[model samples]
Target chain A: MQPGEQRDEVEMLSLMLLIRRFEERASQQYQAQKIGGFCHLYIGQEAVVTGALAAVRDDDYVITAYRDHAYALARGTSADACMAELFGKETGCSRGLGGSMHFFDRKNHMYGGHAIVGAHVPLAVGMAFAIKYRGEDRVTLCFFGDGAINQGSFHEALNLAALYKLPIVFICENNLFAMGTSVKRSTSLKQIVDRAEGYDIPGEIVDGMNFREVRDKVAEIVDSIRKEAHPAFLEVRTYRYRGHSMSDPASYRTKQELEKYRLDDPITRLRAQLTREGKLTNEQFDMLDKRAKETVLAAVKFAEKSPEMPVEQVYDYVYFNGAKE
Target chain B: MREITYRQALNEALAEELERDPNVFLMGEEVAEYHGAYKVSQGLLERFGPRRIIDTPISENGFAGLGIGAAMVGLRPIIEFMTFSLSLVAFDQVVNNAPNMFLMSGGQFNVPITFRGPNGPAHQLAATHSHATENFYASVPGLKVCAPATPSDAKGLLKTAVRDDNPVLVLEAELLYSSKGMVEPPDEELLIPLGKADVKREGTDVSIICYAQTVPLALKVAAQLEEENISAEIVDLRSIKPLDEQTVFDSVAKTHRVVIVEQDHPFCGVGAEICYRIQKNIFDALDAQILRVSQEDVPMPYNERLEKAVLPNADKLVTAVKQVCYA
Candidate 1:
């Protein structure tokens, strides 16, 4: 194995670990009532974002659905800001205006953490449109879950993206169940990639349980997208260990099914790969895990210490032209 | 100043703004090759080319959200709905995503998009096509609604909507598109700022509060009231949101009576808001119970006669004004 590949693999492994630790802490905080409002943990689906974000350029645009904390962290948003955002503190990424669902960092090119299912897909198309209009080489990485594909907006977005040949990669992370209903009940198609046949766009299915696999496939797809300014659909098959949100107990899934998926967790798969490749030692793995825990603990402290947004500034940002609400 | 149709004034406003800013673009269903369904964007394709003048499919929600996304990244997008009635399908994008983007992202993003098209009941167009959506958009906190009554205001207000940093909706009337009115040339840079009411006709007896298509209706009623010696003032609320409350209150204080005219339903319409604002602020000045001349609270009928009866017209305005004037 090349030295650089080993280094990248380690970086991705550490990132997935950080995200995992951050979410576990978030779940604890939400239970404690410190972090309120529909917190969706990105526990088992770390590699999907960790890898896709790794493949894209820094200036390339990225947008996703509400399950967005992992994407934000992977895109270089500080864990403190992400945690504070969940806590709805002024120090949060959205200045506390957007709770756990809406994380926006303009300088990082992270467009937003849009909550509405399938609504932001067209926004991604428009971002790609703007890039094409400006004659730029930027490609947009749009992420959503299995639930969003049923929306008409998603199909419309895909049609427009294909029509204009916009540089965008529609990444669908099909983590088994969309809230309660599984794909067997909701989606009619046998495979999610088949949906792309209507638009005549190229589609691929990737195993999202391994960081290396996701990173390599996305890098290939993004390279073609950047050069040709065409669109591609990628369905990443992964699983979520936790419930849909803090409130959901996930009663639909049996204990055996949950346990079965947990064994194939993305974090474990990446760690095993690194260890097998002789790139990670036992002490180093333990050290990395401790460091991730420490980082998350520090973030929680930061979020706890951060002040709440003042009431006087409630009307702020209602309009960019300074008109009162 | 030359007399031009409201459609031509809007066309000129779009042309001028597109010429001024390279980032500005127009996108809608028939805006490009079709030259706009109502021909409001006629000849724009030849001038601006297909790059800036884009034509989308019949996907209002998709394209509306696309415009908001483009606006989020510094592009000024003028999204045209063939009619405001069709914009109901793109309600989430219009009322939620576009307006709330600025605030939701903690001010990290600004959606400088304008959703413009012919709005309100016109001719014999049935219920689905005829929607006075001023109240719907004006009620949104981040959206600024413009109802230009004349060609000059159409051009000026549209140019301002394009130039403004916020999301502005220029609500034009399909009937008024063909009507001719004086409009200053583009070289004059006519920009009527939002939240300023234009007193269409000044009188001391009664203030006829109105906007958009109702502005013309109120003016005609004022002319009819002139023959009866019941002088009526016309206050055209050009901007619905961030409404010209100062001008409305001043007009109410001076006239001591108000007859509001709106193309929308009576309940919770712009006229209803105006009534509440007037009575809440200038209650003592009111000589009578503030009257409203609004469209009947029912779906528009397809028949021409029934449509006219359902809409706010000179007759409704005259009657409301007479009651306010005690004549």
Candidate 2:
């Protein structure tokens, strides 16, 4: 699209690698007892948010469920901030009150990392409602897992979004399972995108593993959503390499299925695409991989060194202004 | 000053705020076109237009959370519940999302939204419809809760809530919609700060601490107790939370005996919290065990007679004040 288009693609490859290495490091930190609470890794599904963020403008809002390190990273939040959030330090995003599950970057227009299955869907709709109310051209991209579609809140949000003809997209990252229960056992739809028909919204299924495919499809959907100012549904059918949380043993699925999906791993595919384009040499790829690991290593170190929020100031943010004052 | 009903006061406050700030808008079931379920928002749609005075489907959770989301970026939304009993469907938004947004985000966002409309009992609306609602939001950290017992208070607290940089819930009594009192004109900008209580009828013997629907009840009880030479001070806690304990404490100090009256149930009610605070703060000032005249702990019955039986009555408050006075 630009004279430096290949460089941008190579830069995207670096971002995906950074997220992969960052998530791998976070897992180690969780196991080592540095990061507490439920750590849901966005290990395999980095391409979804990576490409989705590429399609949206900086002012357009992005909100997602708890599996959100990649989303935060892709939205330009520092590795230091994201890592420090998991470590529960004052320098972390959310000032360490929300650990692992809630990563909020207000400046970046990333609403938050909401933990509830379908709670944030309505919130995203409200943001989109504001955009339309103000007659702005911004579109909101709301991400949730397959399980969130079953929630009454999700259905209500879908109806309101379509009815109001708000500029918003509901991106369903169908990673097959909601914690332990598979999508088929929970959601009624055979194809998750078909659920949009019930709300009279445009729906599509995209290959989430390929970076270019996710970016192109999401960009197309976003373009129309912005133009017509209508809501749309996008089913990103990807898989997670790890269990739902760190606690999940993943006994719900077998090794063969995992290996089959890993064969078309998102990062590997993107890396190969760059390789086939003759843009990325083996040495350059190794250097980029090493750079991601070093950045993650430094992020871990920064997290380890950051101080925890003091107990005395715990009441600081309870209200906008002090009631007693 | 002009005399107006509680419903009129609310309508004026909303109109003034909508005119004062372009960002402010009203949204809820029957809030527009229908003129509100209780007619509190009558004539707002014609004045403010559909953009500001909007109507919503009966999707409470969606709309409530939607209001919070609208507030997240920067819009002051007044989301009405028609009846706060319906708010139970959106409890997560009220208790979790709205209140917790400010705190959870490290103060990154302030949900400058107000959730209002008819709250508490109205006629024989039975158990499911009539909820005191204070129990759900009273103790919520990031939220401010206000209940106005009179027209002036209704207008003042609402305007204040609209301007306040926090999520506020204004619990209006459905029964008090038609009840009239003096409220300042729109230009007066009748703004009552939250966390303050009003002393409605000053007395010396026993304090009748109450709010919302109970403020009128306490005033009636105060009148009934006056004939028997019992001068009872009435502490109308207009703002339920960030509670105006100083006013309550001052009232209790002047009137050693106390009788807390609430339209809602007794167990773990707002009265119970007030009782705990009074004893803990001014134990020696309390000459008698602070008694409470409250609705009996049972589901509201549709039978008019049984409903009257469940609600606090004049005789119950008279007996309660006399017992404390005698002790």
Candidate 3:
């Protein structure tokens, strides 16, 4: 591997590790009643975001559904800010008003972690439209799950984006389940990409489990999307190691299936490949893993030190224009 | 400079905006080939092509949410609901998503989009179709709400709404589409500033605050009262959300007695807000209690007679003004 590529992989692996450890701690906190409201983890789908985000530009916009903590962190949100948001702290990303489902950092151009299913898709399209209208060269990466593809907003937005040739990339994280029902029961089209034909946009299916492949394919499409100034759809086929959220027992899938996915764990494979190619030393990998865990621990410490959100702050940040006091 | 119907003024405003800004586009159900349900978008598809002036599906939530999203990235989208009642289907998208996006994202993006459509009850439209939600929509903080009464206001307000950095809701009156008046020929682009009320007619006896369709009814009542030597000032509340309380207060201060006329039911309506503001700002100026002339508090009936019986008419304003004057 090239030295620069090796360095990039290390950085990506570090992010994946930080996200995994952060979520594991978050799940524990939820069970212990330390964290409140709903909590969805990206323990399994870390590679999909780590790889996809690596291919995009910082100026480019990104939007996603409620299952969005991963994308927010990958897009440049601090570990402490995300943890504080999950803990509902005053210093959180949304100032603790939005909780886990609505993590947002405008400074990073990361549109909030939306709660509505398939709702943020059109906003992504609109963002792209704005780019095209202004005659700017920027592509938007909108991440959504298989569940959102069935929503009317998804279809209408896709059709409109195609019709207008908006610069948007629709990334479908097809983890095969919508809350509890499998994709088969929820949709007639086995392949989510099939819906793209109806909108006249190009579509592709990718192995979301492989980080390098996901990154290579995303970079290929995202680069062209910037040059072409048109939108494309990507269906990243992957699995979720955890349940839908903290409250779910994950009764939909079996332990064997989970174990089968473990064989292709993006983090494990990437780390092993780096070690085998002599791109990384065992001691170096161990230190990097330890540092990622320490970072997560430090974030937890920071979140724990923060004060709880005041009840009255609930009504704040409702309007950015400051129309309401 | 050119005399045109309210519908024509709106069409002129849209066509003019499209020509000026490549970023501004119009989209909604039947906004293109079908020429809009109200035909306000007629001939736009031919002028701007299918891409810029497009038609969408009947999914209100979907398209409304799309407009919000589209606005965030940089495009200015103009969405149309057939009427205010149909806007309820996308209430979550408008009230929750679009308005909250900027603040929630900590100013990451601003939705420069407009949701325009006919608002309030029309002849024979029942509960399912007839609704005046100016008050409901105005309550939301991030959005700007405007109800244009004249052909000039329609053209001016729509031009301003298209360029606003925040989301705007333009509520058009279905009955006033055919009303004719000369529009200020899309001369220099002017905003006509939001929350400002226009005194359509000046008087000293009593003040009648109305907007949209009711503005004309109040004007007619004022003209009829002229024969009786009772000068009634008609205040047109062009923008309801950022209400022009000063204009209403100034008129109320002079008139002493005041009456509010609205097509919507008075219960928790825009009329109530006008009454509340009048009492709050000019309590000493009033000679008596403020009277509200509004549609009867019930779903609009389809029968022409029943519809006439409930909706605010010149007769109702005449009676309401006399009551306020006598009190």
- Give a tens-digit lDDT track for model 2, residues B1-327: 889998889888999899999999999999899999888889999999998888888789999988999999899999999898999999998888988887777778878899997788878998999888886688788888988899999999999999988899999988898999987776776889999999999999999998999888889888887887899999999998879999999999998989999877788788999999999999999888889988899999999999999898888888899999993
- Model 3, A220-299: lDDT tens per residue? 88778777888899999999899999989999889998999988898988899888888888888888889888887888
Error of 1 at B239 (Å): 0.6
Pick by DockQ: 2 or 3, better one: 2
Instruction: Give the better candidate number (1 or 2) by lDDT.
Output: 1
For model 2 chain B, where is the 10-residue window of minimal lDDT? Answer: B101-110
Residue B69, model 3: lDDT of 74
Q: How far is each candidate from the true structure, as Cα RMSD in Å?
A: 2.1, 1.9, 3.8
Candidate 1 CAPRI level: medium
DockQ of 1: 0.61
Order the candidates by lDDT, highest first: 1, 2, 3
Error of 3 at B221 (Å): 1.5
Tell me, per candidate, how large a share of the native contacts it keeps. 0.73, 0.71, 0.58
lDDT of 2 by residue, A1-325 (tens): 1211222877888999999999999999999999998999988898898888777788889999999888888888899999999998988888888888889999888899898889999999999999999999999999999989999899889988887788999999999999999998987778999999999999999988988888888889888877879999999999999999999989999999999889989989988888998989889999999999999999999999999988988888888874421
